[model samples]
Target: MRTDMPAEIWLDPYRWEALQEILEQDGTDIEEVLQNYLIEVYSDRVPIERQKEVDRRIKKERLAAVQEAEARKVFCAMHIREHGQEYILMEKNGREFLQVAVFLRRYLRNEFTTPPQRVRPGI
Candidate 1:
């Protein structure tokens, strides 16, 4: 991961202070500490209902990502049928569209042989 801090941390004094405190803790995992601190502090900013909605959206997005990855693998397999392996391996345009197409093709074929596992929200 990149070492750069987000602009929000620089803009918020309290957040910066909390970050500094996390950094100052000796022999501890700084990243884990900072993550927990940020989650505890920032999650309070939103209403409970809004947070639930956000959590739901995040879960949906993660599910979509997993589906997309699976579709990409299947799409590559199909593309390899006509265009050869290089077509899937080579850098090319329309990759995102291709993934979607592959997903649709699989759906139409009723070939959901191995569906991606759903991830729990707010992990």
Candidate 2:
């Protein structure tokens, strides 16, 4: 997992201290406030196509995560003849497991070329 680093600023100490005092009075974290401000600005100035691209990337990443988690839970056929434990088994030996793994793998591959698009209102 990637740790999010706080945004770096080049403000002088005087103004920085003033901002900190204001934030202390408001009981808000600077990072949260900055994030909200950035989001607001993004919504205001970013083009719809660019926003859609970002949305697609986020959706694709989320889909990939769900697929990977589900893959870890892929069903393995055990107790079958010649197939004792499916710990390292693949393909027909694992039946449905192969299809799911392959399907997810292909889906992610396609995502690399063409991420799934998001539907938006008034578009």
Candidate 3:
């Protein structure tokens, strides 16, 4: 496969041009068609593997953003007791504040918790 050759040719440039011209003529209902064409053209250039990676990256970034937002929300919730009152749990804290909460919860648990689990499993 020659790299110089067009990866994919637009099959209906005339139709595309006609659509554009019609839109210009009537000035309505062209956004959907243009979006479809744009998506088609975009998909053509982006290889399947690259597209997958791009999608994966996009999803990963979205997830990370959500997670960070959630962490902030949780941190804020844990911090503020009322309109003006700041909770001691979140105010006097460092990065290990959440960890402290976890350890405290574990210590307070009454049920038979699992015995100290191995940090590293046998290989």
Candidate 4:
């Protein structure tokens, strides 16, 4: 259940040279080379169940990112409709405009809760 995972690896000069040599060998594609390297490097450190969990989490994150991107697109379109394309472009280039934009965007999308009205007696 580790949330912080390393996305990349750094290989020293000698190992990198060896990897390049392997890549240059006949009929060896990058996918095969990397797969072999991963097996050699992490085969013992990670179990099959852990690898499956990591893959699942990666997929879930990717799907969430796509959904968030779609939602942002919808919010942007709503903003443009409410305040024209020219105004949107003008605000887009301004410093700290994103803070305002996010507030307006969420408001336009009805993502914020409406405040309760104060009651005046016998209105």
Candidate 5:
């Protein structure tokens, strides 16, 4: 799974604006034009055999990932559904889980705070 954000290519604002205006004169989006341009450049540079091998690997990996996700959904549906049963989760010795809890607490501290108590009418 590709979970990380893509890297950005910074462009000169003035040149980019001029190029964008020219590109959009034909009702074309800059992103679409850039993507097509990249594909054209890659095709011109890379051999057909190498590109085919890379495409095959990408397809295999993505399909395997999709199948694993579907299997996880099936397992959860079969075993983890709401019921009258009690389940206790056991954690292996790891700081990762503890760190996640601490991070969550810091992120959501406002939500967990109690409201101030009301004062008595007559003290």
Candidate 6:
């Protein structure tokens, strides 16, 4: 969301391109390549010097995925702790909908606070 940060940190065009190439290669396992890339490319930290290019591409989807996963975990825990299989229903435009909207509304309030850590391993 911050424009000052470099793009590649989230969006690795090179890695993606590499994956594309590997996909085209005979007998090249794309999954293996992706696994290796994740392990090798991000296992350490992205240097500040390289952050411009590396961090620039960090995608919102990645952050959203991380955030959503965390939110779901928290939401489920809260639901189990605070409210069991209890659900309410409301008719909106003659459509009955399971209304846990209030819970979700509250969950979203705290969801963005604890973002996934700086996942750039090489930094």
Taken over the whole model, the C-alpha lDDT of each candidate is: 0.57, 0.62, 0.56, 0.59, 0.60, 0.49
Q: How accurate is candidate 6 locally (lDDT)?
A: 0.49
Model 4 TM-score (2 dp): 0.36
Which candidate number would show the highest TM-score if scored against the true structure? 5
Could you give candidate 5's per-residue lDDT for residues 5-88 as a string of tens digits? Answer: 454677899988998998889888678887788889989999999999988988888999999976665211111112443322
The TM-score of predicted model 6 comes to 0.18
By the TM-score metric, which is better: model 2 or model 5? 5
lDDT for predicted candidate 3 compared with the true structure: 0.56
Model 6, position 48, has a per-residue lDDT of: 60
Worst 10 residues of 3 by lDDT: 114-123
Q: Once superposed on the true structure, which residue ranges of model 1 sit more than 4 Å away at CA?
A: 1-27, 75-123
Q: How far in Å is the alpha carbon of 50 misplaced in model 1?
A: 0.9
Task: Write model 4 residue lDDT over 1-123, tens digit each, in one string.
Answer: 235443565779798878778777866755576677777777678988998997899889988888987666522222133332222222323345576678566655767575323334443
lDDT of 2 by residue, 63-119 (tens): 888898767763443221223321222233334656756745654465435433333
Error of 2 at 121 (Å): 47
**What is candidate 1's lDDT per residue for 7-123, written digit by digit as tens?**
332337687667667777764554566678888976888788989997788788888888987667632222222322121222223457667677656645757776423333432
Clashes of each: 0, 0, 0, 0, 0, 22
- Candidate 1 vs candidate 2, lDDT winner: 2
Regions of model 2 farther than 4 Å from truth: 1-6, 73-123
Error of 4 at 61 (Å): 0.6
Q: For candidate 5, what is the lDDT?
A: 0.60
lDDT of 6 by residue, 15-38 (tens): 877866868776666556566677
* lDDT comparison, 4 vs 6, better candidate: 4
Q: RMSDs, each prediction?
A: 14.1, 16.0, 14.8, 13.1, 13.9, 16.6
